[model samples]
Target chain A: MHFVDMLVHRWDLARALGRPYAAPDELTRVLNPCGGSAARLAPDDRLLPGDRPGRVTTPAIDDRDDRRGPRAEHGGPTALARRTGRKGSYPMWCSSVLRRPRRLFAVAVLAVAFPGLAACGSGSGGAASAAAPAYAPAATPTATSGAGAGGGTTPPSTPAPMPGMSGMATGAPGAGGATAAGKPVSATRVAIQNFAFSPATVTVKAGTTVTWTNQDSDPHTVTAKSGAGPDSPTLDQGATYQYTFTKAGQYAYLCTIHPFMLGTVVVTP
Target chain B: MSRRQLARHGAWFGAAVALSVVGGEVISSVVGGTTSAAAAADDTATLRFVQVSDSHLGFTGTANPDVTGSFAHAIDQVNALPYRPDFVMHTGDLTHLSTAAQFDQVKQMLGGVRAGSVHTVPGEHDAIHDHGRGYLSTFGAGSAGDGWYSFDLKGVHVLALVNTLSLEKLGHLGPDQLDFVRRDVAGLSSDTPILVFSHIPLFAMYPEWGWGTDDAAQALSHLRRFSSVTCLNGHVHQLFTKTEGTVTFHSATTTAYPLPRPGVGPAPTPQTLPAGRLRAALGIREVSHVQGQTTLAIKDSVLS
Candidate 1:
């Protein structure tokens, strides 16, 4: 009950400040202000976040037969994400250069793929010169000797914690102790990190006990969507919750604290 | 503006309305006098009010470590508005935990705001374990049936609804409130511009997160006849606008921490933005209705 109240109070403060409430319940969701539109979904529903139900219906304003209507389609954040591919909002020139290339080949490819690298390059002349930097090593002799000495001695100390790099490497399922024959192990671990369930979909044998460990600082809970499934209390950072799949069926679960973090356990008999 | 002149500015008016949907970008959109009849109707709209929501007082988290401080800033923002607002409506969630102390603290803080009167509708948070006994005692004055009431401000009829109580999956406005809505607006003419306030969205903004009111369809049925109906709510603390025929729904932002853009993250958890971006996500909304214009100007200003 206290948790629920915490959600509602989001607006009271944000409303007073005229700002976005940071409560889990009060994200800045913009829906059509007018009530009972067949098309409008809750601001959160607009985003196809994992298993959440609700189709993305364009806001009614977008249905208007006006040139301005097209822009309204991008009003919601999900729409904005879809429009920009979740990439940084770049100027038209950069986007145009990137869009024209079908496959990244060479000079044009390098320039379009890494716009930042070609920031100084401008127009057709710049595009041609942009390739020169890539081909020409342009190594100073003094720097080369220092690099030769360091390359052998300094074991690449700058491998500074790449959390995302490790996360991506382990994103594929079966990374959690699968047998060589691809058979599910009796016990496996699922890491909850980066607000996502690593190996979001797992295939496990019946009676397999799946243990979930929270790696992120935020708390999370494993709750079933329906039927009897894994239900765990709030798992704080470094906490572990184990649920044994006794029956053979597909069990879908999510972090109740973070519903978009969906996971599935395929329990095969 | 004359109809011909208004037509000349048609593109500009269209742009203004389009900007409103993006939340806080467009300040106002004047419906040009396409029909002299709409233009001539006595627009009893000389009213301006500020809406503050989701303060989540007593909350302490990285999303917003200083909710009270930010809420105080929100109060300051409201007081700093050029014109003294006639009333300030806090849609709901006055506190993070529905403790007696939290209620008293919010009441005192609200008292300091310079407005004619402060009004509020109970958010789900306001009705915790005791089922709103604490909230009602603190903020429920002259309200009917679990803190729902209506009053005429200027020419507009304003209805404060209670939809947070008895919520199943979505915010629920049981039969009593539904009946109240039907009877409340039955006497008013179809032209009366109505403003409906509730903590949860009276529309189906998102049922999965309980962001919407389940039975709001029935409540809204009673309002379809009105020429202009604007429903303002503050759950899903963000600015959103939707127009369904005569009815328009606007979801305001919060004074607390900002939540993720619907489903951008794993949950609607409070977002901990980079050090300087939290202010951009928090804001207050000012709504103005002119004496003779059908459109109401809603402006959302983020906390500086």
Candidate 2:
């Protein structure tokens, strides 16, 4: 229950920041705004990151034209990733935040579900051990809490960390187990098509070569969002940007031109 | 949402439906300009041409690292078409970063088009830091003020206007060109099928991203009287369309890099989608029309 609660809060923060909030719920997806004239697929119907190579001719159906004519027979990837539905309105955020009953209901539900969870952690031997799990959800935002996560040593008899704690966290999946730059990836391929990247997330063993080819007519870059990844050359159509991930760590990246389009590469030891 | 990005776009969506497709404000009345009618289309188009916009030559970026390759592909698509167009029209942005060498490369590349002639309108990129003096020297043949011109072929009136030459907050055509539009079409018959071309959109697409032209209302007002008018433009880097009465506006996609849909991002920056998805975002658009057929005038707008 506590883990579930923590996941919800992290999901909330991710959604609020307009970041990728892959809580794995299949029902939610921001509607794609490309002016295509066709019915859209339900969110659950979208393929997951490692799902089968998905392809569908763009339903470039012209809504204004009454006759269902033959479509444009062009080949390209499906630009299916969508922004969250929260369309950048501060007032809307304020309103959603101000709704108090939802909070009360959440508390009521948590109380009913785990009745006396206040008793669960107090029985635990030390605070540090219980708090170690907190690092996964709220590590980046709160400096003090994150620093506390550095050591597993617990002062015996300290009470367990309380639930419902709030702080910023950066729990990049497949993160932080590096053996210093491994080797050039053994010819991995990432295709750039339909204004999107295929296999938005990739997990590869160390010592593999990753090649990014821009199949779109647009130019894009494979830029590391943080330390420990190679910056790619601006790739044109049929141009490939190669980067050898030498270390075992999760690397978050985005197209510098289109920052909203994001991807992550996980190098496993 | 970065706090700053959210705050900035929040203001736009607050007063308007930022996410609304073709928001209500886009529909409208006339601005100030002479309203003269144009001739209607004939049973068949006597002449056919292809419009290429935003080739953005010399651009080097991750969004589309190989700009020339795509431009060449577009040219190749044109060359390989079954029916030869009477001419090819390049809307603008013949060069990215507006270098002399870039312009020369584009000119050399464009010289390979199979059309009888190539007509051009300067995009802001072509005007470069020198304010269009370079563009005027290269492609400004028979053009009037700031590289805006008009010519007649196949009984259709084609007007190429340069809105990128002198831009304000949005694109600006200036009073001179607005007046030119007034006088240029004044003598034409009411039934002529007028085709207007420009770089930046003459309509307000998204003011936050500077996708609109400030004085385009004046130019559009002059075109209002025309019975059948089609306005084709490029520069937002994606395809979109809006129709006002007899006048229909189509924004062409780029042959360089794809830009975000209007209001999807703060500005019209190039887009990078998930891996294996970029090809879906890029493709060549070819338009075919035959006389004696019910032509879907805005067919190319749906190519994406």
Estimate every model's Cα lDDT from 0 to 1: 0.54, 0.51
Candidates, DockQ: 0.03, 0.02
Candidate 1: segments with Cα more than 4 A from true spot: A1-67, A70-269, B1-45, B279-304
For residues B98-196, what per-residue lDDT tens digits would candidate 1 score against the true structure? 789999999999999897688999887677556688999998889998999999876778899998766654677899989999999999988777889
Tens-digit lDDT track for model 1 on A146-235?
Answer: 212222211111111222234222233324543222223343677676555655667878888888887665566777878999988667
Q: How close is every model to the real structure, measured as TM-score? A: 0.52, 0.47
- Alpha-carbon lDDT of model 2: 0.51
- Per lDDT, the best of the predicted structures is 1
Scored against the native two-chain complex, candidate 2 gets a DockQ of: 0.02
Every model's Cα RMSD, please? 20.3, 20.4
TM-score of chain B of 1: 0.80
iRMS, all models: 19.2, 19.7
